[model samples]
Target: MNDGPGGPGDQAAYDVVVVGAGVVGTAIARELAHHDLRIAVLDAAADVGDGTSKANTAILHTGFDATPGTLESRLVRRGYDLLEGYAAATGIPVEPLGALLVAWDDEQLAALPKLKAKAEANGYDRTRVIGADEVYRREPRLGPGALGALHVPGESIICPWTTTLAFATEAVRAGVDLRLSTRVGEVVAGDGDRPHEIRTSRGVVRARYVVNAAGLWSDELDRRFGHRGFTVTPRRGELIVFDKLARPL
Candidate 1:
């Protein structure tokens, strides 16, 4: 990946340039590497897995509760299968620990059937309603007066950092250029038979096609291209990683 402090002449021209080295960008880079094309991945961080990807919880959402027949639901389902298979092939650890949506009140209890129906409509039919006895039988140390739970056995977790690393590694191994710490400042579209110019912190990069996968800054980049359909607002979340000994508790 020509990460040297050399000028644009030292950097090889690319057919496609992906702005972001996060999981999504890396995955896109890897997939494009299969084609016979010059590809480059640029990111603002010093290394991959920085930004929101590093802080991800690694949970593989099953979309069991997602609205049925929607684009998001379909994409989630397809992406889940692709990721699951990729993880298995690449030795990325995935834990299918499953999940239980517990109900402590009557209103929540009455929602289990609807949730299960939604799951069914989304083409996931393994969800089931388990009574409180079964809930306590599975999780014996629960508070009193619990009603029921929706057991979704497809929920799983994976190593988010490893997944991103794996994708970046494969993409690099396949000859995709990776340029970290190169934040894109401006994007100039290309004309017919000409290349697009990406103005970055390091230098200008020329590419035939540009992909905006910059995550949080994607909207800002879109604005540079005269499109403003969405905006990104950062949100904070707290994560607690428990040791193996805490699993029993």
Candidate 2:
């Protein structure tokens, strides 16, 4: 992974330096590794998947709730299919149990058709609206009253750790240098034709190009480059895993 003597003065410059060893950075490095270029993936963490990449609900979402006609929505849909196939080909276990958007009241139930329409607009049309009877039949112990539900049979669950590790592993095997415990402190832009200097806790790294996939710190990194376009507001997402017995409810 080229951690030894990798400082700017000691090691040669890389063609591309991707900051952050999370799934996105690793995937980018893997994709770039196919070409004839020197590349490195750096992260502050001790290991890959040590950040938000490891903290997800592990749902292979279908982007059914995403607003249609948006870039994020489109990407989500495309990425879902890509990852689904990637999981199958690479042996990443994924359970396609689908999802139920339960509606408890008349107002929510009334929104089901619009929500279904939105899903269709996003290129998913497999949703089915089931009545209270069917909802209760499927989940007999469901509390009090679930007036109706929208069944999305394509939504599935996945293993986020395995997914990130798989990407990092493939990138490393494909000749991409994986540098851990490397925290980028500052970026020194190069003059025309010169390489950018990245000051890290470990040492300085010179790269012809840099990609910031730093997750929570991405906006901070962008500001380092003198950009004020957007800001990142970190939010907390909690996922609770229930036992198989809860399946009845």
Candidate 3:
């Protein structure tokens, strides 16, 4: 990455400016770098992946439980393959330990088949419904009362930090400018033959096109662009870390 210097006044006009340097933003920047466009990635944080992307569970899902026939399901299934391959190619650490959606009650146990069918519909057919005996056999340390489980062997864990860094690094190497600690506040449309003016905490950035990957602040950015198609409601999740002794479980 170019650690030389970054600010609005230090850079030239860009063909495309991608707001937010999280995983999604950096990925978009990297992909855009493949073209002939001059791209710039802006982030409020001091570094890439400093937002919610760093705090995620880092699970490489198999889309085994996504709602079928939706864009989310299709993208997730396709992204799984793409990211898995990218992780391998970039030498990002990945542990294909798989996962088991344990069913603790009769109602949930009955839903196993439905989940398997859903996975199939999402183009993932590697799911298997296993009884309690098999569940216990596979995970003997698991608590009792698991009626059954949907075993998704494609479910894996990856390094979220490495993944985002890989994307940012590749984007920078491919001639995409990365501007960190630059928070975008407003976007002003320009007239014919003029680039849009983006006001940021640091200074102004001029770009012909702007892409929003701002995650939680995407809705706010959309509103700045004179659109209110959706709202972003932040959700919280907790991650518990255990010592190596708990690795077996």
Model 3 misses residue 65 by how many Å? 0.7
TM-score of 3: 0.94
lDDT tens readout by residue for model 2, 1-249: 364655343354889999998889988998899999998888999999898899878888898889899998999999999999999999999999888899999999999999999999999999999999988887777888799999999999999999989999988888888888889888888766889888877788889989989999999888776778689999877778899897645
Model 1: residues with Cα > 4 Å off, grouped in runs: 1-3, 8-11, 241-244
**Model 3: per-residue Cα lDDT over 1-249, one tens digit each:** 333336335445789999999999999999999999989999999999999899888999888788999999989989999999999998999999989999999999988899899899999989999989999999999997999999999999999999999999999999998989888988887656989888877778889999999999999998988889899998877779889898877
State the C-alpha lDDT per candidate.
0.89, 0.87, 0.90
Candidate 1 global Cα RMSD:
1.7
Ranked candidates, highest lDDT first: 3, 1, 2
Please give the TM-score that candidate 1 achieves against the real structure: 0.94
Clashing pairs in 2: none
Model 2: per-residue Cα lDDT at residue 119:
93
Best by lDDT: 3
Write out the backbone clash pairs for model 3.
Answer: none
